[model samples]
Target chain A: MRKIKMIVEYDGSNYHGFQSQKNAHTIQDTIENALYKLTGHKIPIISAGRTDRGVHALGQVIAFETEAKIPSDKFYLALNSVLPEDIRILNSKEVETDFHPRFQAIKKQYSYYIYTKDSGKTFLRKFAWCNSEPLNIDDMIKACKQFEGRHNFLSFCSSGSSVKTFERTIEVCQLQQKNAYLKFDIKANGFLYNMARIIVGTVVDVGRGKIKVNDINDIIKARDRNAAGSTAPPQGLYLMYVEY
Target chain B: MRKIKMIVEYDGSNYHGFQSQKNAHTIQDTIENALYKLTGHKIPIISAGRTDRGVHALGQVIAFETEAKIPSDKFYLALNSVLPEDIRILNSKEVETDFHPRFQAIKKQYSYYIYTKDSGKTFLRKFAWCNSEPLNIDDMIKACKQFEGRHNFLSFCSSGSSVKTFERTIEVCQLQQKNAYLKFDIKANGFLYNMARIIVGTVVDVGRGKIKVNDINDIIKARDRNAAGSTAPPQGLYLMYVEY
Candidate 1:
């Protein structure tokens, strides 16, 4: 069996999540069903990360074993022909038999977009979070800087995640303003469940002057979910890249 | 009674269209219902343009008469509170008694976004037209320039529109590209039904070398619907702004 690695893109609005569950539609189930149609085998695929419901991914990575005779370049086109318009295979390549997309991933990048206008634009309503309140970009940036290092990010992550360790390295964290949108670009070695959304929520509170910038360290030290800001909505989070 | 003009935004994926039709969910009908809930009377709103099904808008302008005593600034917040998350009133102000959103509009700007990547990102799937092909952007720019001046766009218009004259002045037409997305920003005194989409489709053909740059002028001169390219999908077209 050859290991096939693929770059996948999906609109997660109508999906239960990335994981396959009984009686629930999910991105994984959709692609796996399409693969079953193509290869005539139900091959379970592994993803770099599991996205929650209503969360989206632009370049999500996945891998699966297949005995089909098709070439690597033909995998993307063949799978895409059977996939729905909302889900697509961006690229495909062959990988080592021992390679795992999730375990071997060195870093992952995610972007959270916020339409900061007094009202949201029509097309972006389903994708970006709309907040009419004035957000202090400077304060948000200052708070974001505090998160740019290795720390036990227990407070920033939601409870009930299967992760055993809260320690993770955040290599880069940035807040950028473009036109009427504020985008958060974050890169980390690993992330816990709903970590990025909780980070954004905490920073948003800082921008709204509800929390002090230095409070981020204390929250991280507290290792408590309730110590952080409320979890930001799922529509704003996007998995941008997974580096192997 | 005071005439109030509103700049509205809505996701049209779930609506029939802009105009109110029997037994169908239209953007106009939804907003009117919200208005009726706020005031105890029915008020008909006139829109600057009527967008087709699955089309979205950012700066669509509508005007209605109301005898309510709410402050003008409060109109934005009050209406937003009652409106669904998919539709929002971005701005509201009192206009001249003679001001008509449809009749007195000086110019309108519309943009068509095309996702020309091998595959589109998940979050943008609903808002952008997904076309999988590498096209020459320079050729599109050259052909798009021919549409910048006053011209009779009869050929680009859809059939069944009852406008007497097809002559319209185009103040600006620009084709801009970023990464995998290409946007055509076109401003004109008025657009024929499906004119923007047809124009975008025709330009995309030019970009793909399916049509010559000079063929745009010839097509316009033909003044026949068959002379234009296929009507692009409605989701890609956005009513950007209107000046009254």
Candidate 2:
């Protein structure tokens, strides 16, 4: 069997997530079904990240083994032809047998978008979280700085995550505004379960004056899930990239 | 009775169109229902434009007569509190009794987006039309210039429009590239049915080298619907703004 690597893009609105679940629609299941139809082979597809329901992805990488007769370049077109309009195979190429999408991923970048306009039209509601309340950017920026270095993010993670290690290094944490939107771009070697969402929730709390900027450090030191902010909604989060 | 002008935003995915259709979901129906819940009166809403199914709107303007006791400035919050998540009232204020959303409108702007990237992520699928081939912007710009000013746009309108006059003034027509996305923003005094979408479809043909730039004038002169390009999908078209 030959291993093939692909870049994927999808609308997560109708999907349960990236992984397979019984009776639920998933990005993996749709792509795998499409691949099976194209090559008449049942292949196991692995992704770099398993995004939650309603969370979108761009540059998401996936790898699968196949014995199809088509060349590597043709796989992109072939798979895209069979995929749904909401899902797309961006690029496809032959990869070394040992190459695994998740195992080989060295870093991941995620972006969270919030529309701070007093009102947004219906068109942008799904892609962004509309916050009519004016947020304090200075206070939020100060709170975000506390998450820049290595730390145990257990307090920021949601419960039911099976990760054994909660300690991870954040390479970069940057926030900026564009037009009426505020974007949070965070890069790290690894992230714990719901870490980015919880981070945003905490930052929003700071913006709302519910928590002080320095409260971030105190929350992290507590190592308790309840000590951090609530989990922000999934609509605003996007998996921007994965480096392998 | 007070005439209130509202700047509305809505996702058209679930609606038949902006108008109230028989036994179909519509933006008008949704907003009217919400307004009825807020004020126990059946208020008729007049809008600046009527968008098709799967279309989206940002700054659509509407006006309605209501006897509700809510403050004019608080209309945005009051209506939004009762509206569904897909629809939002961005701004509201008391308008003169003579102010009518459709008749008093000075201009309207619409934008069509195309994804010309070879591959794209999942997040932008609903917001743009994905084309595998790269577009020729130079050719498209030349074609767009031919469409400016007042002329008979009969060839560019949708199939079922019954408007008597086909003359409309195109105030602004421009195209821009944002990352891997190509967007066309056009402003006009009025549109003849699906004029913006048809213009986008024809220009896209020029960008794809399927049609010559000079053919736009011929299509306009021909005054036959078949002479123009295909009607683009509704998903990529947005009612950007409606001005009074």
Candidate 3:
């Protein structure tokens, strides 16, 4: 058997999520079906991240074992032929049998988009969030800087997540405005359930003058859900890339 | 009574076309419904162009008379509140009673988009054409220049189009590449049925190395429908702007 590593991209608007669930339409389920059609394998496909509903991905990594003799480059074309138009395989290669996407990943980066104007309402409505209010980008950028470095991000995570620890290290967080949109990039060792959305909500509140930039210190120290801002919507977040 | 002239943008994936048709969803019908909901006026909307099915619009102009008490500036927010997410009125202002979207227009511009890569299948799939083959954009740009100036474009016009004449002057035909996409912009005094699509198809043929850049001259002189290339798909075309 040969171990195959794949880099995938997807538009996740209509999918339940990246993880496979019983009786639910998902990205993993779709890929498995395509794999079964190509290689007749009923095995699991492991991914680096299990993104939430309506969350997009640019370079999501996956690994699986196959006994088929098809070449690595040909799998990209064969899988795309059967996969839906929203899901595509960007690259495929053979790896060692012990390779694991999650354990080997050193960092992951994500992006969130916000559309602030009604003028440029082209076909991007599905990819970005539309917030009608004017935002103070200077304040939002300042708040984003506070999210850098290590922190116990318990308040930034969802309430019911069953995780071993609430501590994680953030490598970088930068915000930039492009035309009518506000885009932010965040890189971390690991993320909790809805952590990115919660952080964006808190920073957007800073942009709106509801929460001061310095107040982020108290919110992180509290480590309580109610102390942080509300969770933003899911459609705006994207799993941008993973570093090994 | 005030004649309101508005600049509109839309994603035309789900609509039959820009013009209102019997028992069909259209951009005009959607905007008219929003107008009725706001001002209680059931009036016809006159547009600068009647785009085909799956054809989008960026700065499509429309004119209609209204007696609503709402100010012109606030109409943008009011209409957007009720309009579907795909359609938007970017600008609205009261114009002279004699101003017309079609008759007063000096020129119209259109754009066509083609995606050349197989990776990163995202929301843009609904807005562009995917061609897997490698394209020669430099050759295509040379062919684009041949399409400029005044010409009797009977061969480029679709059959069964009842027009008084087949003569139109082209101001520009420019091609550019952005990442994995090839985009072309065209400006003209007027267009016949499927004229823009047929021109795009011809230009794409040159890029694919199927036709010579010099063959366009003979094709134009033949005045036969069989001399020109097939009409490109409607989804790749956009009515970019109307200059009035």
Candidate 4:
């Protein structure tokens, strides 16, 4: 058997999520079905990030083991020819038999986009969160800095996650504004369920003056989900990169 | 009665075209329906450009006469509340009663986006034309200059147009490349049916080495549709601005 690693990109607008489920449309099921048509075998793949519904991805990493005879480097072209237009294989290569996508990952980066125009842009409605109300960028920037460090992120995690620990190390947290759009980027060792979105929500509240900037530290220390702001919607979140 | 001139924007992926048809969904029909809901009477609207199906617009100018008591500038906000997510009124103001969107227009600008990456971008699939083949940008740029000045564009115009004159002066024709994307912008006094798309198709053909760059002038002089290249698809075309 050969181990194959691939970088995938998907819109995720019409998908339930990255993970496969019964009686639902998903990115995993669509790709796996395309793989079945290509290799004539049921190939279950593993991904580094199992993104939630409506969350897009630019460089999602996945690995799978197969007994097919096709060369690994050519897998992207072959699979893209069969896969739907919303999901595409960007790069594919053979990897060591023991190589795993999730376990050996060192860091992951995510970005959330916000359209701050008074009138929303029609072309960007599916990809960006439209917040017409004015946001204090300086306050939002100050709040982002508070998130960069090791902390117990229990306040930012949603319910129903099976993880044992709520602690994670955040390496980078920053916000950049271009024209009428604001992009929030964060890098971390790992993320709990809805951690990024919750953090963004809290930061947005700070920008809106609903919460103070210096209170982010207290929110993290509170270690309670209710202490954080509401979870931002999934459409604005994008899994940007996975580093191993 | 007040004459209202509005700048509109729309994602035309789901509509038949800008013009209203008997049984098909269109941008015009949607807006008219929205206007009827806001006002108590049936009001017809005139647009600067009747974009084809799947052709987007960022600054489409439209005018209408209404007896509604709402302020002209506030009409955008009120109409947007009732309009669908894909269509938006960007700006609205009272205009002279004789202001016609089509006949009084002095110039119009349009843009076409092309994605040249070997692998298509999932997010951009709906808005850009994806051509994996390598293109010669310099050759295409040279061909763009030939499209400037006044010339008989009958060779580039598609059939079924009712215009009496085929001569139109182009003020600007340029192509800008950013990473894997190319944007072609053109400004003209007016356009024939499918003229901009055909011009792009011909320039693309020049980039692909299918046609010589110098042959453009002769093709325009020929004044026959058979002498021109194929019509580029409508999804990549956007009515950028309409000037009066």
Candidate 5:
């Protein structure tokens, strides 16, 4: 048996999410199905994180144990041949048997894209959040500084998450404006359920004047989900990469 | 009655082309239905050009005569409310009553995008053509100069097209590479059925060494559909705009 790690890219708009369900189609299920067809393995492949429905990924990481004789480099080509067009294996390699995608991951990067009413990127609707008005970029950028460093991000996490703790270190939080789009890029040691999305929502609210920028400190200190702004829609959130 | 002209954008993946047909969900029918709901007019819209199935458009022009009380600018918002998410009216204005979208159009700009195997833009599979090997962009750009200026484009048009004349003036033809994407932008006075796609296919063939760059002039002069390379797929083609 050999352990393998793969970087995957997927347009998650058509998927129900990352985790497999009984009837719905999920990214995890689609990849597992393809893997079964290729290697006849039935075990669940471990992922760095489980994404919500409609959330896309650029460099999502996954690991699995297999005994197939295929070479490491050929694995991506083989998997991509059998996988759907929306999901592709970007790269693959053999890893140590003890490697765990989640536990061994040091940091993760995510990006959120927003299209305001003034922009006309209609084809990117599935990959971006479309709002009625353009968010104030200046205010959003200022509020991003509040998210830097370690914090108990329970206020940014969704309810029903049974994690042991909400403490996470945000290494970077940036807002970039390119033409008609506002992109939010964030890097963190680890994220709670929907933490990145909630942070985006809070920043957007700050830009919209619905939430004060200084109030972000209190929201993190409160450690209450209701203390933060609403969780942004899943479509705009992207799992950019995982650093191991 | 007012002649309303609108610049529209759409993701053509789900559409059965730009023309209306029985038992098909076309962009034309969808827009007509939305217009009918917004206004009581059941008249069909006239478009600058009819796009085949799965061909996208960023600034497709359409015109229709309406007696609705809604202002010209407000029509876009009202129609978009009833239209599908993939289709959007970018702009609307009042046009001359006798102006015909096709007959009065002077030029049109179209682009074809190719995602090379090296790029991980797998998310754009539905909107671009993906190829494994890298295409020779330098040779392709050189061949583009041969396409500039007026010529009989019969060889570059698909069969079964019965146009009055095959002469069309090519204003510009350029192939540009950005990262892993190859974009072919062309401006022409007019195009025959699948003309732009056939031209792109020939250019791609030239890049692959299947056809010589110097052979393009002879192919255009042949005035035979068989003289050109195969027609490229529709998904990669985008109608950028129509100049009136």
Candidate 6:
């Protein structure tokens, strides 16, 4: 058996999520179905990140073992011919038999987009969170600095995650504004369920003056889900890349 | 009755076109239906440009006469509440009874986007034309200047147009490349049927070395539709704005 690793990109607007479920359209299921058609076998794949519904990805990583004879480098082109237009294999290559996508990942980067225009841009509605109200970007920028370090992110995690600990190290957190759009990018070793969204929501609340910038440290220390702001919608979040 | 003018934006992926037709989903038909719901009257709208199917618009101008008692500025909010998410009213105001959206327009701007990346970016698939091959942008940029000033654009105009003359002045024609995306922007006093798209297609041909830069003048002088390159797809075209 040969192990193959591929970088995947997908628009998650029409998908339930990355994981498979009964009678639901999902990115993983669609790709696996396409693989079945290509290799004539059921192939179970593992991914670096199991993104939430409506969350997009630019460089999602996945791996699978197969006995098919197709060359490793040509897998992307062969799979793209069969997969739907919304999902694509950007790159594919043979990997060591023991290589695992999730357990061997060192860093992951995510970006959340916000459209701050008074009027909506129809083309961007599916990909961005639209907020007409003015946001204090300086306050949001200041609050981003607070998230860069090791911390117990229990306040930022949602319920139902089976994790060993709430502690994670954030290497980078920054906000950038271009025209009427704001992008919040964060890089971390790992993320808990809805951690990125909750952090973005809290930062947005700070931008809206609902939460003070000086209180971000306290909120993280509180270690309670209720202490954080509401979770931002999934449509605005993007899993940018994963490094291993 | 009061005449209302509005700046409209729409993603045309779901619509047949901007014009209304029997049993066809269109931008005009959808907006008119929303108008009927708001005013309890069947009202027709006049647009500055009737975009082709799959063509988007960021600042399309439209006007309609209404007997509804709602404030003119508030009409946008009222109509937006009933319209689908793909269509939006960017701005609205009361206009003179004699004002017309198309007849009185002074200038219009349109943009065509091309994605020159080897792999498609999932988020931009619906908005840009993806071409993996390398393009000679310097050649394309040189050809843009040839389109300026008054000229008989018969070679660029497609069939099925009812215009009296093909002579139009292109005020601005330029190409800007940011990373792997190329934007061809053109401003003109008027356009013939499929004129902008045909011009872009011809320019792209120039970029591919399929046509020489020096031969542009001869192609325009030919004044034959067959003399120009193929028509670019409607999905890459955008009616950026119409000026009064």
The top-ranked prediction according to DockQ is: 5
* Candidate 2: Cα lDDT at B111: 91
User: CAPRI verdict on model 1?
Assistant: medium
Give candidate 1 misplaced runs (Cα > 4 Å): B67-73, B96-98
Report the C-alpha lDDT of model 5 over B60-123, residue by residue, as the tens digit.
Answer: 9999999998899878988999999899998899988998999999999999998886445667
lDDT of 3 by residue, B15-83 (tens): 999989999999999999999998888978899998989999988999999889889767777888899
Count of clashes in candidate 3: 0
Per-residue alpha-carbon lDDT of candidate 5 for residues A1-244, written as tens digits (9 for 90 to 100): 8899999999999999998899999999999999999988785799999999999999899999888889987899999989998898988999999999999999999999997754456777888888767567788999999999999898998987889988999999999987667899999999999999999999999999999989999989998888899888999999999999
Query: Docking quality tier of candidate 3?
Result: medium
Model 2 Cα lDDT, one tens digit per residue, A36-115:
99988888999999999988887789998888888998898999899998888878999999998887889999999898
Q: What lDDT tens digits, residue by residue, belong to model 6 across residues B105-187?
A: 99999999988886546777778787767779999999999999999999999999999899999999999998888999999
Tell me what TM-score chain B of candidate 1 gets against the true chain B: 0.97
Q: What is the DockQ of candidate 1?
A: 0.57
Candidate 5 clashes between residue pairs 3 or more apart in a chain or in different chains: none
Docking class of 6: medium
Colliding pairs, model 2 = A9-B121, A9-B122, A10-B122, A122-B9, A122-B10
lDDT tens readout by residue for model 4, A24-143: 899999989999999999999999999999999998999999999989999888998999989989999999999989999999999999998755369888798888788899999999
| Candidate 3 chain B weakest ten by summed lDDT | B117-126
Candidate 5 at residue A24, lDDT?
Answer: 97
Clashes of 5: 0
- Alpha-carbon runs more than 4 Å astray in model 4: A118-120, B118-120
Using all chains and alpha carbons, the TM-scores for the candidates as numbered come to: 0.90, 0.89, 0.90, 0.94, 0.94, 0.98
Q: Quick one: best TM-score, which candidate? A: 6
